[model samples]
Target: MLDDRQTRTEKLAGEIADAILEGTLEPGSRLDEHMLAGRYGTSRTPVREALRQLATTGLIELRPRRGAIVAKVTSEQLEMLFIAMGELEATCARLSAMSMTPIERRRLGAHYDQMGEMVAQDDVPAYTAANTALHAMFYAGAHNPVLSEMTAGLRRRLAPFRRAQFRAPGRLARSHAEHGAVVRAVLAGDAASAHAAMLHHVSLVEDAFEQLAGAPAGTAPEAARMKAG
Candidate 1:
């Protein structure tokens, strides 16, 4: 039932969301409709729709007269999101540990191998992509689709601030190590350890967001490092 324009608008929305997650679209940046339309090879109508979608997800804010701008991530919001993310991921780990079958754990092991390759190469883009996959797969492994959906929504909402964590010095390497620990804990079926490890992983992000607030706004915040997985 979807028309071409509607499909295009949805696709553009996804692209914009990805850009926000990757830190290419910095927070608080104004989104000019004409420019976005030109950038995406579309008309203003589609661009507007895409912006509307981002607004609904809380990634961007639409203002009267001033138009749309990337939503500013305040310190309080950052802390709240980070804290919530930790709790949610901890719950995911606990659920996955209690419910995942041996075969599911094996599949997660393979995915970890793929992640290892990305980490070894220090390929941020590949690692980021794999990070997303690992987290999604974990939710699946947990046997709770509802929790996965909720977590996914939260991730999208906090994408910009999350990406900024990767900019911190030595964060990527530390994150890689932490991810390995999380994998081991999950594979071992240690529900408590898994929960704690996941919380620790998300706490790293909290540290990054805090450091970012101490610095000037609009500055790149990627150095702090986070294990989104």
Candidate 2:
């Protein structure tokens, strides 16, 4: 069915995105559709669709004749993206604090607790999924469709870089603690506090990525340095 093919393409795109984030697929490296199709045990059609999808996320660059390559972002561009994302998310958090219903607040808290468990178990993938859900919940709680759509678009564009930060050692715990501040502020209906907390959390995420930027993706030398200390 058409839906199944779409699902498969999405799955392939996610796998390629992960590879790019982890440095297995280095930025600027050409992605051959034939090779990818062979690797994923599929035809070129799904591979092409997957590449097209990634291109929209700013993770893949499609050339007229050169095929697809991982998109390379300059440090300045990354900084701008993070700054924009932080501001947008902070606004959402503030609005959520002011607008979220009691049930929404409770559900957000429950999701935060589940993320903590994922962190404790060292389940990075699950934690990442939960983290994505938590942010979506914040957007939903804000009760602003336009703001939510804009934030979601930016988040998608920066998804790979943002996800890569979790590879830093102790990042999961730190992120959870940061989320706690946001959750507490939101639950208390302190919009200013929620805004501040969310902004701080996003800044820390940028810091985490900066710390890892120098090393090969999977190695995370900053993590090792912290552990050695």
**Top candidate (TM-score):** 2
Per-prediction TM-score: 0.77, 0.88
Q: Give candidate 2's error at residue 203 in angstroms.
A: 0.9
- Write one digit per residue (lDDT tens) for candidate 1, span 58-104: 77899999899877545455567778888988889888888889988
Clashing pairs for predicted structure model 2, backbone only: none
Tens-digit lDDT string for candidate 2 (1-229) = 9999988987898888877765677777899988998888999999999999889778789998998988775666667788999999999999999999999999999999989899989999899889999999889999999999999989988876778788788999999999999999999999999999999999998888777665644543222223223
TM-score of 2: 0.88
Q: Give candidate 2's error at residue 144 in angstroms.
A: 0.7
| Model 1 spans > 4 angstroms off | 1-30, 39-46, 63-66, 212-229
lDDT minimum window of 10 residues, candidate 1: 220-229
